[model samples]
Target: MSLKWVDVQEIAIQLVDSRPGVDPRFVNFVDLHQWVLALPEFNDDPRHGGEKVLEAIQAAWIEEAD
Candidate 1:
């Protein structure tokens, strides 16, 4: 399944799986944005990922990490 910026939960899941042991709480938005773009299943416009979307992704990632 392809991932977009709207797919925050799924992206967070993928991030948790791909980057094990990494704390989402400490990750910056720039790195988070790049990481999402780098995901093999991700396919979306980079511009679509604004601060709100990134915040949602980070929140989901933090939850998934717990």
Candidate 2:
């Protein structure tokens, strides 16, 4: 499933807002991905790559709003 840039931005912002100690500027997906990757638990997640994490977030978002 393809994701729009705005959608990615929105999701990233929401995630950043929800998490503790996350900077608001990390709404930028690339930065967000890099930040997330640094977290130990994320190493075990299948969506390890930046693109995959973005895609997975989009997919989960679609499922959640339905």
Candidate 3:
């Protein structure tokens, strides 16, 4: 399934799956944004992601990681 910046949970799941040992809490927004874009299922407009979106994604990722 295709994922967008708005698909926070799906993106977090993908992130946790892709980087199994990584801690989402320590990830920077720059790296997080790039990582999300790099996900195979991600197909959102790159410009659409901002601090708020990144924050949500990070929060979801942290939850998924735990």
Candidate 4:
């Protein structure tokens, strides 16, 4: 399935799966944005991933990591 910026939980799961050893708490928005774009299932407009969306993704990822 394709992923959009609104698919925060799914994106977080994907991030956890893809970057196994990484800590989401230490991730910056810039890297988080790029990582979301790089996900194989992600298929949304890069411009649509704004700061708020990135923040949500990061928060979700942190939860998934825990």
Alpha-carbon local distance difference test for all models: 0.96, 0.49, 0.94, 0.94
What is the overall TM-score of model 2 with all chains considered together?
0.34
Candidate 1: where are CA atoms >4 Å away?
none
* Candidate 2 lDDT, 1-66, residue by residue in tens: 223433444454455445646444324557556554543334334254456656666454444443
User: Model 2's lDDT to the true fold?
Assistant: 0.49
Total clashes, candidate 2?
A: 0
After aligning candidate 4 to the native by TM-score, how far in Å is the CA of 10 from where it should be? 0.2
Answer with 1 or 2, whichever has the higher lDDT.
1
TM-score of each: 0.97, 0.34, 0.96, 0.96
Go through the candidates in order and give the clash count of each.
0, 0, 0, 0
Weakest ten-residue segment in model 4 by summed lDDT: 53-62
**Tens digit of per-residue lDDT, candidate 3, span 1-66:** 889888999999999999998989999999999999999999989999999999999999999988
Which of the two, 1 or 3, has more TM-score?
Answer: 1
**CA displacement after TM-score superposition, residue 25 of candidate 2 (Å):** 10
Better of 2 and 3 by TM-score: 3
Pairs with steric clashes in candidate 2: none
Residue-level lDDT tens digits of model 1 in 1-66: 899899999999999999997899999999999999999999999999999999999999999999
**Total backbone collisions, model 1:** 0
**Model 3 misplaced stretches (Cα beyond 4 Å):** none
What value does the lDDT take at residue 58 in candidate 2?
A: 44
